[model samples]
Target: MEVSVNQDNFSILECFSSPTRIRIIELLNERPMNIRSLSEALDIKPPIVTRHIQMLEQAGIVASELIAGKRGQQKLCSLKLEQMVLNFRSQIHNKKPSVQKYDVMIPVGMYADYEVKPSCGLASEHSMLGMCDDPRYFADPVHRDARVVWFSSGFIEYRIPNYMLYNEQASSLEVSLEICSETPCSSSHLQPSDIVFSFNGIDVAVWTFPGKIGKGTAIFTPQWWHKDIQHGVMKHIRVNEQGTFIDGVLVSNMTIDALSLCADEEIVMRISSRSDAKRCGGVTLFGSGFGNYNQDIHCTITCK
Candidate 1:
């Protein structure tokens, strides 16, 4: 998560003020635990543990779900963020605004190229595109209509149209879409997927999604679609003069100028989870009909 020292973010900032809350975060980092477990570990009462978790949850620092326990339901809590990037950017208010921009709306399935493994599939709002886990189905003529696509391991590439003129100097590129980690067991807390983003084959940034947000399903998901993995967080990735940023966090030195946007007639955007990545959980892309945000891959380009 990216944050600044502002009044709106004070709730998140306050999470560090209490030693008990800090300890709760540290324990959740190790693994998801119940209130009873945390109370026993910290030598505190169950009600007190709940109060601390409530504070963390309010700040978007932690999440929990109710499940059956020995006597009654239990709240299984987990860390909502893998990490946070803090920016002391008082200078941001002094900078000039953007000049001009253009947008490209590309469907999730309109991939120019792909190399996918099993535990992969694509589907439209009305029906499944082809058999699940089969790579050949990805080439079906109807694949272009897919609204949601997922894979256990491999990369999918989309060629985003470059609308900037030849003489225009591209300033930044931003891509936003809904996505989440795909796990076989439908486990959201423990399984993390390291998703890598690339523009023109140059890896721009990588983010480790902290699994599915919760047991809740995406608001826009079709009723026919049934999967253990339900919802996803909307992610915004921007590449500008300074560097590549994910959710406003600088993740790399790859700047917009490095991409030579005008030289390439089209930008090849790729999303992948390499088997070698530290967190090898798969990836799922939500489109107009399938995820929290009812939209396809949205790419915007600003020019100087």
Candidate 2:
């Protein structure tokens, strides 16, 4: 597909300009509402709502569906933020972020740990034993890598190189990865996770997954996945120095923290899934299905 916004051109800038359109996005973010609902929510007439909806829809910012309402068919409206880039300044381009490195000599797997539940059950290429058998296995205090299916309510700790301590101009550190969980399957109900990244056991940031991540993968099929419910239900969380991004859009400003690591201590990112079966059906970790940080679900640290 067409990836990366070329420049801060008209088509891109227009995506965020209109006041009515912005209100429409804000209203839809809460829950999908039809014409009457949106009209009441935004204090606009039905004709005005329809006009703005059409404009937003044309820009691919909003979409509508005809669903059964209390009376007749209702055009349920919602936002479709598949992915977008907002450039407040023209200095940056709609391309991948730049990466630079300071020379260092260290072991490859020096600061990484992974665990899976049910012994080697998650090692299978295609199975669900690790995630479905028991929800507690996710917090089993051991096991890491998985293949078919796995769940964990604990953090996957990765100690980053303590290069930031000595580096004079290390502006920021960026950690990006593809992650999804079983707890909250659908993006529609996308809720934040309790996953925390810690520096020397000090909590740095609490992260959550974005909506509609693994939409086409079979891994999203729950034990009781029904045709009535949306299949390929999944969510993703990708954060960097700029902001926290879910799916492909920016959601929050809780970016990765730059820490001093010259003491030779490990910088860790721990992902914890709260034990809420009602929220996440439990936590199913999708390793390879997501991008896995543009490489493996591993850690990367660069210091200037």
Candidate 3:
């Protein structure tokens, strides 16, 4: 999870203020456990442990669900974030160069082009778009309303409306979205898929998603939605003169210059998994209504 180091992320930052909360995270990291188990291990009361878990949940750092325990039912808690980066740059991006920039929220369903196969389907906040595991449903007229989309193979493309003027040259581009491996609803199935990101049809970044279907519900996921794929890791794909980065880690040497974007040219971003990829597991895209983040595919462009 990437959080800007500012007042906007005060809740996330405050998560580290309490020793009890820190210890709780350390314990959950070992394995998923119930609040009763946590209370016993930490020598704390179950009520206090539940309160701590609630604070962590508010920060999107922990996930919990009600399940049948040996006695009856209990709230099972688990660590949700594998890594967290407090980015200081995001809050100060307008320091130098041109301030001419724009941000857009492109819904996951608003794909301009796509080529997908079975084990695929999409749904909005209220209901499924069409039939599950059917490629034909992807073309249904109402698909534009999809907030959660998944496919076992192939690619999906979206048009990022370029807002730069003819005299403007892009200095950097950043896109953030929630994604995970596509797999049938099974907590045991942790599918790892190599997902490739391209701009204007040119491959720029590639990363392997260590996917797992969580049993707990996402922060923004509606109650009607199934726990098939609870939530996905939020990823930040950035392109600059230096190189391409995924979550601040350089994934490719390919620089932003490779895109060669021009005026009146809408950038085409393609997310694909090669058929021969060693880990051709699949992909799932989460949007405003179905993931931890209550936002769509966010694109930001800064130009000079």
Candidate 4:
């Protein structure tokens, strides 16, 4: 099935549409299940399930194995799509001078300032003072007492120190963050909305959210949250000789060298909403409180 993707795109929607295929994905998402178990749960004939399983295997969505069993060899199946993204970019290439490399992970809470309030299920994980979800969460003298949940029309800014930059050396900067939908809900059904990541003053990248928490993946979440809608993912971007990127794909034709930041310049990654913003795709900035998952969301700059 043909579909449109935003940036760093991968095709998996086709695999998700078939009822049988989706069931297979869900079952495997929890743990590897043998074909017999899946067949019973789906209530489909074993042969029919086998046919669908083959299709899924070809699509790289499922994998099967032969295990020793009394009846014979049992085939097991599992999911491969940890997270799927649809990314598109205008260009890739740079004509300007290059700089030095630097890498770092910006935690969720270490910003110049931020506003957060209690959403459902945050009180137990975080000590709450009031019954409402208000801006007061940011005012708590102690961050541990602050509500872990928050949404923003505003930006969570990160200030990159100047020491990282070096003159005329080839380098690129990468950033990682943990983010999700603002409106806490199950079965995330919100429409596509834009979330912008800016570096310096340039509009570096724009990502569209599928809505709700579980659509991608998440971190430091309470068990009470439904699993289906609690998804979140890490987007890798490069600011190198090849220009800006969300993954390996270029955000523009301009290469990293062209998007110049002087050695002494301060860099900012502003996560904010689009003008047509509809849902609360507000982000969760994870740092010291939320340990890094390594691949979830990371920013870096590298050079020879």
Instruction: Name the top TM-score candidate.
Output: 3
- 191-303 in candidate 4: lDDT tens per residue? 44477777776777777765533444433444454434343444555666656766566776546666565667766766776434665455443332221121223455555
lDDT of 3 by residue, 1-304 (tens): 4588899789889989999999999998766678988999999999999999999999999988876667898888877665687888783746645468778999999998899978788889998877888889888878899998888889999999999999999877889898888643323365889999999888998889976554466766788986567678778898988899887788888887889978788999999977889998888899987766656999988888
TM-scores of the candidates are: 0.67, 0.41, 0.70, 0.53
User: Residue 181 deviation, candidate 2, in Å?
Assistant: 2.4
Q: Write the per-residue lDDT of candidate 1 for residues 217-271, one digit (tens) a residue.
A: 5555788876766657778899999999887789999999888788449999999
Worst-scoring 10-residue span by lDDT in model 2: 225-234
User: Candidate 1 regions off by >4 Å?
Assistant: 1-98, 183-190
lDDT by residue (72-131, candidate 2, tens digit) is: 888767665545555454444466545455333222122255443321123222333244
Give the root-mean-square deviation of each candidate in angstroms: 8.4, 11.4, 6.9, 10.3
Q: Which clashing pairs does model 3 show?
A: none
Q: After superposition, how far is residue 86 of candidate 3 from its true place, in Å?
A: 12
Q: Which is better, 2 or 4, measured by lDDT?
A: 4
Candidates 1 and 2, the one with greater TM-score: 1
CA lDDT of each prediction against the hidden true structure = 0.82, 0.47, 0.83, 0.54
Once fitted onto the true fold, the runs of candidate 2 whose alpha carbons sit more than 4 angstroms away are: 1-99, 102-121, 126-145, 161-165, 183-263, 276-281, 289-295
